[model samples]
Target: MPDGGLDPVIHAPARLRVVATLAALGPGDELSFPKLQKLLDMTAGNLSTHLRKLEDAGYVHVTKTHEGRTPATYLRLTGAGRAAFEAYTTALTTLLRGTAS
Candidate 1:
């Protein structure tokens, strides 16, 4: 994004939902893949695709682990991501208010 513009990386609808959900978590908090999938009501593949994009953008951090015989994925928004989301919201509000007047 350039100068108060919305970030393309965080602007897509599905990705936005994913970011918004993760942003709700407290700092240092993380969510497991299955739990996030349930919260977003998204298919594993769908969520994975979006997650990959966010991860590539340096906006999200992903961790892979094993729980007994099972594999688990955990996700959290990074500091840059939180900052970007905050900027996005502020820009969106400004845009909306501009049209309202």
Candidate 2:
């Protein structure tokens, strides 16, 4: 959603849902992988694939650590990500409004 355009990366349906969910969190807040998966109703592999793409695009930050013996993965949107999502929404809204009768 940079340069006043839609982001093909975030435009994908699953990725859009992921970004929307993460965007709902407060800045610097994080969501556990399981929690996000449950929230989005996405299988582990499906979510992982999309997340990997977002991370590669520098829109998502993924952290891996240990909670006792269990491994934990947490996700948050980067500043660029926040900006991109904002732009995406603005563009989408504009597009929709233009089409409204």
Candidate 3:
């Protein structure tokens, strides 16, 4: 979006999708990396990159461990992240409504 245009609450499509998915799940529920990848239909590398961005932004928390033979990665949203996502959705809704009117 342009500087004068509406500053979107969720700027990146993939990030928005991630946040939206997390919001749909029960609060504090953690999603495994592979599961989230399947849900988003995103590649491991791509998902990792997006997740890194979210992690850096303090929107998501990542945990890595080994489940016997395989490695596991889990993601959960932070309180601030959840609140920001909610605000963004609300802003988007209002903007869409204004345009419709």
Candidate 4:
């Protein structure tokens, strides 16, 4: 939980999970759509919809490319996304700290 309630912009379940996963990866790291779908245990369509939402909010970057004869999609978090995620974590930490007193 966070103070003043979680920011809806980052509080969305799918979006929150997406940001958490991205935060766990290395810098300049990226994940493929299929890989992410598997990791999140979500349907392709479901994951696609979530990803689109994140992309629209400038929280994630989606890249579509061709790999020989096949299509490849990569997802990564933007700088703004990273900052927001960090803030979310910090808020959660602060809230927990208050409870620990």
- Residue 42 lDDT in candidate 2: 96
lDDT for each residue of candidate 4 in 1-101, tens digit (9 for 90 to 100): 44444556778788788889987887568999989888999899988888888788787888999999999999999887888888887777867778533
Positional deviation of 96 in candidate 3, in angstroms? 0.5
The per-prediction CA RMSD against the true structure, in angstroms, equals 2.4, 3.0, 3.0, 2.7
Ranking by TM-score: 1, 2, 4, 3
Give the Cα RMSD of candidate 4: 2.7
TM-score-superior candidate, 2 or 3: 2
What does candidate 3's lDDT look like per residue over 1-101, in tens digits? 43223234356898888888887877788999989999999999998888888888788889999999998989998887898787776667767777523
Model 1: CA > 4 A from native:
2-4, 99-101
Compute each candidate's TM-score over C-alphas. 0.92, 0.92, 0.85, 0.85
Whichever of 3 and 4 has more lDDT, that candidate is 4
| Candidate 2 Cα RMSD after full superposition onto the native fold (Å) | 3.0
lDDT of 1 by residue, 1-101 (tens): 56358898899999999999999999769999999999999999999999999999899999999999999999999999999899899888887778522
Question: What's the C-alpha lDDT at position 14 in model 4?
Answer: 82
TM-score of 4: 0.85
Q: Give the TM-score of candidate 2.
A: 0.92
